[model samples]
Target: MAEVQQNTGGDGKKGQQKKMQIRVDFTPMVDMNMLLITFFMLCTTMIKSQTLTIALPSNEKVDNVENMSQASEDDAVTIILDAKRKAGSMEVDTVNGKVVPVVYYYFGKPGGPEGLGDAPETIAARNNLQESEFLGNDEKSGKARGIREIIQQRNKDVLTEINKLKEKYASGGFGSLETKEGREKAQLAYDEAASKVRKDENLKKPVIIIKSTPQASFGSLVSVLDEMQINSISKYQIDNMTKADSVMVIDYQNRHHK
Candidate 1:
């Protein structure tokens, strides 16, 4: 009887052991999951969205005549920023004029020879010049001068002067134009362009119209504006064709489940 009882006890112990076999040790798995979560949390970046601040024209009511003639050829300057190129390029266009190539110089890189210089001074000096100088002035000197001819002349003169300065710098002359001076000159050239547009006889009080793609960043726009030396008298407007009544509707019931 004692032997039989012992056998029964041993059978019970085997059954308990078999039941315990299915149990898993999940502590290591839990620890690994925690570690992965922490790592991902630390590695992930918290992206922040930024909104561009632009002053829009007031929606005040005006006389029909005033509204009809709000923008005169002389009153507004148009700047077109196109990022559609394989490498983005900015072009400036006038009310009734063809697109003119405008170069943008970054502080650190070797930009095109067209646009480069420092701040307000160079730009201010440029503004004093007549539009004919940029767009092309008809030479009264009985010489044939088209817009392209004038542009070429200006480019040649500018490049010649710049090359001389660069050569001087290479020769280790202390009086040579430094990088800062070059940047300043470039900015002055851009401002001069803006001034020409504003003072153009073809337009009245020139309004600066900027046409930029959605892909264009605010920094690019700001840089151009800064170079132009635009002030309180100038007005900036955006071209958005979307209607105010447009609304987006989504239907969730029709969505497919994979």
Candidate 2:
């Protein structure tokens, strides 16, 4: 509420009209503005940070064979993550204000059948390590690019159904995408669809085993995990780098660095 006051000044000149000035009280307005600010500050929602929830295995070894998840060599894809190294040195390399992540992957075991076998002669032939990098979706096609593309290619059998689900989601098959409540419903529906595809035994999906070097950035690790999620891979897990995994990464970097 506001109040107005009228003031009259008089020189009292003959036949001259008197002037009136109106003043508006601003104290109420100032108080109202403060209250509005406080109310908005209290009512506004803050964004929450997202996280990946991983289930860790127990320390004790499982005695039951049925409890362990086993994979055949044909269905296994091993992804090794490392920080790009300087030529002729083990030093980490950076590019464009970011730590460069080097990715090497292989189907089946490290060093192939011989398993990083006895010596250098066999190691060279069987190393089986191929390099790649984490890349975002293509600007034009909107399809995933880089390492993501490679993984998706291997898991296309599952992606065929997942892509359909994506199309359904975009078309509002789950719910209206325009509103907040609708988006939530759509996401739940999408998750359910993808989950069904992942668990479908009839569909063939690659089991990705992710191993990272100590020198790699946490961001790179997260980026790789994002690929797994984006690809709808249900069988991937974070695993420790074995001696062979470490050796293969070193050999790949050394040979390629030159």
Q: Pick the candidate with the highest lDDT.
A: 2
Model 2: worst 10 consecutive residues (lDDT sum): 63-72
On residues 42-120, what C-alpha lDDT tens digit does candidate 1 reach at each position? 9988987855456655565454235334433333433434322222222333333333333211111111123223443
Q: Rate the local accuracy (lDDT) of all candidates.
A: 0.38, 0.82
The candidate that wins on TM-score is 2
Q: Model 2: how far is 151 from its true place, Å?
A: 0.7
Candidate 2 regions off by >4 Å?
A: 1-46, 61-72, 170-189
Give per-residue CA lDDT, model 2, range 188-216, as digits (tens).
Answer: 98988889999999999898988889998
Model 1, poorest ten-residue lDDT window? 244-253
Candidate 1: stretches off by over 4 Å: 1-34, 39-45, 58-75, 83-207, 212-234, 239-258
